[model samples]
Target chain A: MLNPGSLTVIGLGPGSPAQRTPEVEAALAEATDLVGYAPYVARVPHRPGLYRHASDNRVELDRARHALQLAEAGARVAVVSGGDAGVFAMASAVFEALEAGDPAWRALDIRVLPGISAMFAAAARIGAPLGHDFCAISLSDNLKPWEVIQHRLLAAALGGFVMALYNPLSRARPWQLGAAFTLLRQHLPGTVPVIFATAVTRPDERITVTTLAEADPALADMRTLVMVGTAATRLLPRPGGAAPWVYSPRSVPAS
Target chain B: MLNPGSLTVIGLGPGSPAQRTPEVEAALAEATDLVGYAPYVARVPHRPGLYRHASDNRVELDRARHALQLAEAGARVAVVSGGDAGVFAMASAVFEALEAGDPAWRALDIRVLPGISAMFAAAARIGAPLGHDFCAISLSDNLKPWEVIQHRLLAAALGGFVMALYNPLSRARPWQLGAAFTLLRQHLPGTVPVIFATAVTRPDERITVTTLAEADPALADMRTLVMVGTAATRLLPRPGGAAPWVYSPRSVPAS
Candidate 1:
């Protein structure tokens, strides 16, 4: 039997109202409760019937639990995340809570609606830097040990995979991106392009492309998404003195 | 000086009309020419002034060249690709053409619009199997050597990445998925979940969850997007015996 309650985990896309999928918009419109980080919850305009449960950024688990509890109470809850919810976002958190929480939440008509990921938004701003095989790694050591990050970074480099590094650097995690760069340098060439795409599609978006040797972690903040190209990635000058386009060719790069 | 001609490459998202973003829809509606594979081109309804150039799927380069040439001739051309265009799609092919074609082509305006990827759509259908660090690898040997695929697959596995495998299998290349499974078995535990999500969100969509050891290559086709879970991926039974929810937690996995 279906529960009267329903919970939807929706990705708002990378900060643009235009980037949000139609399905996600419909879900948000129909939701009785909006639950997420304060910034993400604020993205959706306030409506009289919709209750917004904006919480601290660090409390994903608690936020997830609250959303589930509301859903069980017969509220149509929408838990929002920026970018695609399936990729390192609220979908995972909601699933984690569902697995460990009351068994009754399972039948609560849970669905995850996807949105354009920040990684893809950043990649699109350049040419297709992720045209070939690629991996995405998080630089924050808050959840995993620093050793694990290093191991994955080195392995991704050795695999010749183009990489999109999320949470590259922050006030508390200032050193991880630099350390990641040093480890990657051992495996990749100096000429490989490293792109720091900040606040993609938003008014303050800035995209900087430099070689691996010249890459400085100082350019990145918590809002930035860093992309390290494979050896095959190329940079071409624009005909009108615009920023050069960067992309990895579709064919195989030497491994 | 900016050329009057413009070219835009757009992602159509996973087969669902509602999944497409408004920006992509606007691009498609304003397009003078739509260039892409036949199926993707057919997705858009016929309009009075829109000319469609549906071509063979294998001729990505020639189609890309045709689109660029049209754009140079002052046509507002849109090149469409199913799923995210930057992910092993038309965006890279267009760049490759631009690099090798007439230098004057560089003057043409080009933009890539992000779309929801089939990988993300597939991940949402199941729970968030890609919640943690992950990689996307195409299984087709058409663009790269089987050896290179093996090397990278091993690297991603060693890095403990949940993998989203695109173009997983086809009659043209029958053994790659099986070979990949055999190679991955050397490093990952058999208990790791393997999700085969086919033609996601389409009328004929199918999703099967199996363990690494029990995964069958026959379950996939060219339309399939396969996901392999990491050690941290978990599965939980529904209260009403619906399909179990599967996800990788946000916290660190034992690496």
Candidate 2:
């Protein structure tokens, strides 16, 4: 049912139009107000009845509140995020806004539409390094302490988890990813595969597969997703010497 | 370009047709052979040229080899998997086969299509409990040792990761999920939210949101995906006493 005043949180799916689900497309078509980060909002096509409410990054909560306000005022709203909105995106912020906002807002209809996350999209472009048990950690220390990130990295490395690291490096936090690599090197074998996927699914996409020993911090930027494979991961040699296929096997022999 | 003898690994996206991406849909339309677990293969629409090759569960390697051989014989093959194929699904098995099989298989065109994984779909059904740092661990001990699963469970719990546990409980591994709960209970608060989502996005879908103290192992089965929220997760009170929203906040206060 199309509620007159409702908020639908939808993912844009890593900058590719083909990756967007039909449900998300329907939500966008129905939306009177589109609210999201500026880059993500710019991805949507301009329509006559739709109002684009684009804001800068790091203002997720403010964006969530704006969507809620629009919905409360009887506007059909779609809150957008690149990749899956639930994964380190605007869905959580929307819920946080609903939690702290007027109690009447709780009665408003809200839906979250899932999409292909950046980690999965990147993993797919370069075979599947996340084809086994994995963990996703955001290296940006904007919220959590650096100590927590360090501890989790050590835990993931020691546990033999294939890891997808989001926001690996930014101008402000240049040293965190290097420190994380150092911690992994201490526990994981140097032969383990590490994939650096930058701007995945976009025209400027770059996917590189390297070993843990050869992994450089500079290979990753804010737009990159770094996938570190477990010891069991394999690098298949391509015929004619193309980029090798990187993937983790499904089975692990009994310990 | 659509290669005549190509292999495309596609995700069915948690059982909903609307959840399937157009890229995957196009791959299905172009495939001459469809291979996967019985239930997932059964989801594909019937077509005159498509040959459905459905096999029982746990025969992933055999299925992969079959698909490869068919593709090698100049058939456009689509390997289908429920949810995202990369996440503990056929994508890994296919890669393993390619690495161990004839080197000629390496020259074949291969692609993996990402979809909405069970964890993401389950998270959206309620609210985004995975809106922060998270780990996905497969609970079935069919491959890895039980001890490894236990250690990772504890690591994820202690590390304050919102966790999505796949293959939580099967008939053969009925006790594994319970053991995981016991391990988590030691490190996490009893008030943390635990969501058991069974057959997500399917007609018979069941979603239960409970507290760590009250979560019952019997409530989950092989088809269930269990999500445990972090200490930072919130449960919003619904207006008129409906189901409360469950979500983890995007930011964490410094420890």
Candidate 2 CAPRI assessment class: high
**lDDT (Cα, tens digit) per residue for candidate 2, span A119-236:** 9999888788898789999998887888889988988887778999998989888998899889899999999999999988899998889999999989988889999998998988
All candidates' lDDT scores?
0.92, 0.90
Q: Residues B9-93, candidate 2, lDDT per residue (tens digit)?
A: 9988999888899999999998999999999999998989889999998888999999999998899999999999899998989
Q: Which pairs in model 2 have colliding backbones?
A: none
Q: Candidate 1, overall lDDT?
A: 0.92
TM-score of each: 0.98, 0.97
Q: Best lDDT goes to which candidate?
A: 1
Candidate 1 clashes between residue pairs 3 or more apart in a chain or in different chains: none
Task: Give the top-scoring candidate (DockQ).
Answer: 2
Q: After superposing candidate 1, which stretches have Cα over 4 Å from the reference?
A: A253-255, B239-241, B253-255
lDDT of 1 at B96: 95
Candidate 2 segments whose C-alpha is farther than 4 A from its true place: A1-3, B1-3, B240-242
